[model samples]
Target: MREIFIERRDRILRIAVKEKGQLYECFIEEEEERNEPLCGEIYKGRIKNIVPAISAVFVDIGHKRDAQMNMKKGRTYKQGDEVIVEVLTEQIGNKGAKVTEEYSVAGRYAVLTVNRQGLSVSRRIKDERIINNLKNELVLPNDVAVTIRTSAEDTDVLHVNKEIDSIYEKICDINEKSKYILKPQRVYGENSLLHKVLIDNINNQTSKIVVDSKDDYELIKKYIGDEDEIDVILHEDYRTMFDYYGIEREIVSLRHNTVNLKNGGQIVIDKTEALYAIDVNSSKNISHGNKFDTAKNTNMEAAYEIGKQVRLRNLSGMIIVDFIKMRDDKDKADVLNALRKAFYNDKTNTRIYPFTELDLVQISRRKKGKSIYSYIEEKCEACDGHGKRLKLSYIENLIRNEILRVEGENAINDFYIELSEHYEKSVKGDIFTFLKEIEGITKNIYLNFVPGIDSFKVEPLLFKKQVENLAKYKVNNIEFC
Candidate 1:
């Protein structure tokens, strides 16, 4: 059975996809990660400089760094001209966002593209009648084109039409918004993460969806309206939804370097500046049969697990895998086939090459964003950059979890957490904004700033009324947070 769990926390949103209680994929988005507009976002930009040699132009989209857009052959534009552009790639390091003039809006069942002129059906949709019916039933604008997605095969025509209408209306709104704006700024953007998970994973095989936020539940309900085959559940619990469902521990397990298979096999993953390396070992999974049989069985299991780990960790770029040595070419072929089937449904563009003479397999995947480690960890100064330490945001989350645990165990809802100035500076907004959700359950939570402290300390307040009356008063040179 396939299930999706959506959890919303302070400054973060997490989505997990599981099959038979095993985590298949995880996606996390934080508020601070949105400092730049994500890929596929639309912006009305002002042309800044043109580079004729590369056929690209620089655009000012109201960001500190200017974006770059490639010009089509026969398209001409001068500086200070206004144009509509879509972000094709995110900004990396010193590079600006890569954009395109061609705009597109993707829906669950179809995608509408500008400056393209064709009605194309997905290769997966092989039914002649369905293809012909969609071609005849759908009506689009003369200038725009539409592509029928694989999910549209068994879908109702009216729903597809409704999505087209919705997309066109959105396009109209963007045009309307851009007409009056003389400056470069964002015109429209989609919450791509949630929509992507829903569109890609929640299909005919999806059995259940559990979301903690009511607003997310409503959005999902509207997206998958009247789908009686799947269950949409709203998680209402005092404990965090991820913790209640045992997904929190599973997510933490991804940080480990070794993965143990069900049959006593092991896959060890390591990364360097060059490429990610995976080693498969038979370990205790040796069978009573010959060496080839033992190696084949373990390698086959490891192949499947490696693909799952790649998606879970978002491992991209060049990757190398070393499987247990096998003599028979047929066994190697079988192991390779298993690995291919594992990544058959992966959305990212991945290319797998044949096994080399030494039996190392090479796989290349397009990079989307930073890896899971980059988001959650930082270089450890104490270890001289050889190790990684959790980021301050994650530490803040641990503090929040500790606060929740204390509130759950004790009867009092009044408490104050003391943090050093170094830790307090990491917080972006008001302390109440960070702890308000906790305060809703804990009633009143206060922050006490103490100097020279390494981390944080949480203590209960005996006199809640007295503490509130003396609001901003400093006691022994400690200020309130």
Candidate 2:
């Protein structure tokens, strides 16, 4: 019950993911609104900076941005040599675009990395001779960089060789036409949005590719072949594609992760700077009193969400998920095995480990760059990303302390107390009235919801500007700006 769709926007690409007719995830290829993915682009550029200390170099790839190369994460090369590197990460930050000397350009069926560097047949295809046979047929098209794409699996050798040759000839042409040894730059070949989607997502479960544009059809046909047997389906009307599939309503929900589980438990997923945390909670139907049953129920619910998230968001690297703890080791084993089996359909290679000492399950997946969330959403302005919410009991304590301090002052006018929402809820109408009875303080105090428990602010409401000026100056460390 898994499905995926590729939607081309302006020039950028967005993926539509669904499980059992429910839309689970959506991903924009990058930050740009229009115009295709940039990975596997062969660019000619001048060395911008070469720092031996960092063992990194930056190159201006003649686009609006500079291409970066790290000798550590980047391959080794001496300075001032005019060299070719593929665009690994797009430049959109204070940090330049990430580029690698060791890179591959992808196409349907296979990924072609530079030169005769041996073949790595995907684990899905175990036929070693099939790969060797393809490699033997691959003759040099005059030493231009290329890597065979995964989509090229079972592809005709003659067609693969012809397309690869066409790409290599184009790379050589760029080198010949470049204006200078150090200053001038040129770009060779890059894939369109439709082309990239097929190579990246068109695997075992891709039922069909629904393309609204005819231009995409020709490009897809060019690379993957126009045979009727291919799953690439050209759409005459996009309305039918979405209406028959409920793609529109599903995409809207994916914007905010409100993942619901079938077994009557829910998980709240919050992404933090340190790591992504998933808190499993028991919902209405899943209120099993036994610790093992409850833990297994929620963990099983969480496992389904995790599986959908792996492909939907294309999350990568180290992930530490907090699953509700269980007393029995057998219940733990059951949940762990379920999670492992859930990820079997994932396109990316995923490694899952049992719950750690912190009661957190650790997962690792390979990532190319920034996450899917970072590409689409900005951090919340109010919370400012500490993810610390408010509590009622905490507010009661702070208010009691503030009330006692106010009565002791004898002559106090107005004060501003800034705290998190949880704290404010503790000292709202009824609680505030009951607490004030103990101190009988004759002072006006205002409460400000500051989003996090660690955050604190004090203000003399009457003497606003004076306290405000000192407000920015006085902090925990007092590192005034």
Model 1 misplaced stretches (Cα beyond 4 Å): 52-55, 402-406, 409-481
Task: Estimate every model's Cα lDDT from 0 to 1.
Answer: 0.80, 0.58
Report residue 214 deviation for candidate 1 (angstroms).
Answer: 3.2
- Kindly report which residue stretches of model 2 are placed more than 4 angstroms away from their true locations once superposed: 1-13, 17-25, 29-37, 63-65, 72-79, 126-186, 189-192, 203-207, 230-245, 285-289, 316-318, 327-354, 365-481
> Model 2, range 113-219, lDDT digits (tens) per residue?
55335555565555788778776887644443445655566667887777766655555565576644455343555444345555565544445555556776676
The TM-score values for the models, in the order shown, are: 0.81, 0.63
Cα lDDT of model 1 by residue, 1-481, tens digit: 8999999875788899999888888888888666786777899999999999998899998888899988788887899999888887778778899888788888888888877777888877989999999999998777778888888987898889998899888888888999999888888776777887897887887999999999999999988888898899999876677777878678767778899998788999999988999999888886647777888899999999999999999999899999999888999999999999889778788898889999999999987656778766766554577877556566566556666667677776666666655545444244445564334333665566667675567666667675775455323233445
TM-score of 2: 0.63
The RMSD of every model to the true structure, in order and in angstroms, is 5.8, 15.0
